[model samples]
Target: MTVTIRDASLADLSVIASIYADAVLTGTASYEIVAPDETEMKKRFQSVTSQGYPYIAAVDESGDVLGYAYASAFRTRPAYRWLVEDSIYLAPAARGKGIGRLLLAELVARCEALGFRQMVAVIGGASPASIAVHQACGFRMVGTLTGTGFKLGQWLDTVFMQIALGDGNASEPDPESYPGTLFAG
Candidate 1:
């Protein structure tokens, strides 16, 4: 099935929250045990987009949200502003179809365009599929937190992967650029 990646809107929050809830409850893609409702999800959507970061949804030809992805501050400290973390969640039917990779590629492109210099993947549960997907999109394993997550009656590892974005660290960013406040740090 053809999947289209586009900016996520409030109208898509319900479906996006549903996709994330499944991951929260059954999958280890997210460390959040209690799934947030659509309202909370909308707040999160606004927070990310308001920061000039991207929140995107992957939809099928029928306009159904197959999955969603986004980038957010890797850390709140101003020194970490140029680095961002990525999150992706897919409907059960959407997995194994390479949709995650496509969504991630788009997210990376968007973040790069926004002047983000680094993209990080904090893959919960050491999920091989997630790890492979990130690797396929140019992410390299930076580290892993052993037994950092407790879920589904077992200890889980969180894998950290990273990739350089446009001109990544090859040159200094212009402080007066698109992502204005960030480059100054």
Candidate 2:
């Protein structure tokens, strides 16, 4: 089946919220089992687009949000502007059908369009599928923070994966010197 990838708007937050909450409550895909409600989800969606980061959704016919991806600051410090962290989530039945791959590929493209120089993916240790997905998307394993994330009465380890897209010969840009404004509280 061919899925169309498009920029997610504020109107699409409900379905994106459901997908995220589904992963949080019923799946080990994310370590956080505390699923957020629609209000919180709306804020998350708003934050992504408001900051000029692409919040993309994969939709089947009839515009159902089967999955989504977005990027956010890798670190708050001025040095990290070119570095962004990524998130991809798919509906349960949509798994293993190239939905994740499509969203991730689109995410990298969008981030690059926004002048991002690198991407970092933080995956729960239990999600080898996610790890493999990012690896297949050109991310390399960097390190692991053992027993760092706690959820569902258990501590989960986090694996860090990174991809560098910057021109290797260029000097690092000072994040604060950039004229772009970022949405932050």
Poorest 10 consecutive residues by lDDT, candidate 2: 176-185
Give candidate 2's root-mean-square deviation (CA, Å): 2.6
Model 1 clash pairs are none
Provide the RMSD of all predictions against the true structure, rounded to 1 decimal: 1.6, 2.6
Candidate 2 ranges beyond 4 A from true positions:
168-170, 174-180, 183-185
Taking the tens digit of each residue's C-alpha lDDT, what string does model 1 give over 1-185?
A: 77899998898988998998999999887888999999899899888888788889999999999999999988887778888999999999999999999999999999899888999999999999999999999999999999998999999999999999999899997656647343343
lDDT of 2 by residue, 73-141 (tens): 877776677888999999888999888988998898877766778889988755788988898899899
Write out the backbone clash pairs for model 2.
none
Best prediction by TM-score: 1
Best by lDDT: 1
lDDT of 1 at 7: 92
Query: What is the number of residue pairs that collide in model 1?
Result: 0
